[model samples]
Every structure is written in C-alpha cells, then in structure tokens.
Target: MSIRHCYLQALALSTLLLFSGLSLALEKPIGPAVLRISGLVTQPNMLQQAVFDMQMLQALPQHSFTTQTPWYPEPVKFTGPLLRHVLAAAGSAGENITAIALNDYRTEIPFSDALKYELIVAILMNGQPMPVREKGPLFLVYPFDSQAELQAATFYNRSAWQLRALQIK
Candidate 1:
C-alpha cells in the first residue's frame, strides 16, 4: 500500500478501537441493589414507612417539628420517614452505616440508633422541600428533645443532613 493509504488505514483502526472502549465505559456498573428514591412521591400505606423515594417522601403522611440546629439559629420544621424505616428498606442489621450527601459529605451512624431509637430522615421542613442551603432533601434527626441521651454532640454529628445515600456495612 502507498504511504497515504497506510496512514488512513491506521487512523480508521484507532477510531474503531476508541469507539468500542467508549461504549463499554458507558455501560452501567453491576452489583448492589441500587434504588433511586429521588423525585418519587411519598404515600401512606404501611409500606410507606419502609423504602421510599423523594417524591414518595413528599406524598407520605407528613410529620412536622420545629427544632434548632448548630447550623441554623431559628428552629426548622423537619419532615420525612422514620430512620428505622430507611434501615429496614436497606435490609440493614449492621453496627455502622455510612451516609453520603449529594455534595459528597459523609458520616457514620450507629446501627443501634436505627434499631432502638426513633431517628428520622427529614425530607422536608416548614411544609417545603429542603434546599441545599437549608439542609434539605434528607436530614437524619434524633429526638434530642424527647431523649436527653441523644442530645450529645456525637449523636448530633451522626445526624447527617442533606443525605443522598446510605450504605450499610
């Protein structure tokens, strides 16, 4: 083959290989029972207390409570499913869980809290969705007012706000 033809052939072969690799990379990664709970409406069945998406969270029976946080001055109304419900959905029975936020912030919570305490994943506040600045979408909260033991700073730190993911390990 002439020099120009040889160069064209090599270019075509490289392009084919690149496209093939890109296709494979674009394929979804396997493993894990990934459930998306965002943009789904909350409902009011017994199962509603279990696994739920964001839209479902909004639709479910609403519970509102105003509480103060270190991040804010005035108390904020928190609404969402009980933490126990979320744990049950994940089939979690471990001692620790890693909660990740949309911004990649993460914290670890004791499994005992979910199993024994009335912690909640607050999806709303003051009858409105929680924006990122307001610690919205999802906020893990312990009944600090009801349970004095839960008012400690350690528990407060574990009460991750703006939560997006939960991995029980």
Candidate 2:
C-alpha cells in the first residue's frame, strides 16, 4: 500500500481505539444489591463508612434509642449507624450535605450536627426493617431524646426519611 494511505489508516485506527477506551472507562457498572449513585469508589477511605445499603446498615453494630417526635404518638426506637461513620466512609468533609429521599424529598444537614451527635441513617425501626410506606430502606435520624436541642422544628425538618442520595457541599 502507499505510505500516505498506510499512515492515514493507522491514524484512524488509533483514534478509534482511544475513543473506545474512553467510553469504556466512563461506563458504570450495575449489580443486584449495590447502587452506584454517582462518582466512583476508590480505595476504602474515611467515607466508606458513610454510605450504606439496607443490608450493610443492618449488618453493622446496631445503635438503638427511644425518641419522641411530632410525627409519632409515642417515643420511637430507631436503629442504625451513627451519621459520622457514614460521612467518614464517604470521605466527606463539608459544611453541608444535601440529602434526597426516594420520594424526592430533599433537605440539607449541617456537618456539625453529624460530627457532634449520634445522628444515624437508620434502616430499621423497633427491631424490624422499615418499608417505603413505613419510612424504610434508610432514614436520617438524630438522637432527639438525648439532646433537647435536637428536638426543635428545624432539626425535625432536616431528618430525611427513605434517603437515597447525599451530595456534600
């Protein structure tokens, strides 16, 4: 073949290969149990503990507390991992995290509260897994009974239930 034709053919092949690799690298993976909401998971960092599936949250050492809230008639028993642990897992270090629930309910939580309190992303209630109707899968809960300061209207509004995504900002 002519040298010019060969050179052009090689250049086109290289361009195709480079573009193909880029596309493959950007493709996301899907699994039965785990969901990749956004970004990529690198080495297990401080924030690895921050993100959890329903099963993973249940498997971890459970923390339970009875708390009274306007939503319920009686004090409720909440069970889940401390919010800080989850934030640590996600390697999050921000002033606020915008939480989005399954039903698209969204709220922003201050990082200070997560660091100071035993706020948790709860998957179970009263020893039973919560369903969507019952606010299941995940719920951002604060130890309202432990600290009267957390029982205010503002904190109650930030407690997002059936949480699906948390974007740090």
Report the lDDT tens digits of candidate 1 across residue range 1-169.
Answer: 3568545534443453354232211112133212232211122122322234565444434455666766667776677767655443333344467777777787888766775766778876777777778776678887666667776898888888777766654
- The local distance difference test score of model 2 is 0.63
Q: lDDT values of the candidates?
A: 0.57, 0.63
Compared with the true structure, the alpha-carbon lDDT of candidate 1 equals 0.57
Q: Model 1, stretches more than 4 Å misplaced?
A: 1-52, 58-62
Against the true structure, candidate 1 reaches a TM-score of: 0.63
lDDT of 2 by residue, 44-144 (tens): 32233233455544444567888997778988899887765554444345557787888889898876677678888887788788887888667788888
On lDDT, the leading prediction is: 2
How many clashes (backbone atoms < 3 Å, residues ≥3 apart in a chain or on different chains) does model 2 have?
A: 11
Displacement of residue 154 (Cα, Å) in model 2 is 0.7
Best by TM-score: 2
Give model 2 RMSD, 1 decimal: 15.3
Q: Give TM per candidate.
A: 0.63, 0.70
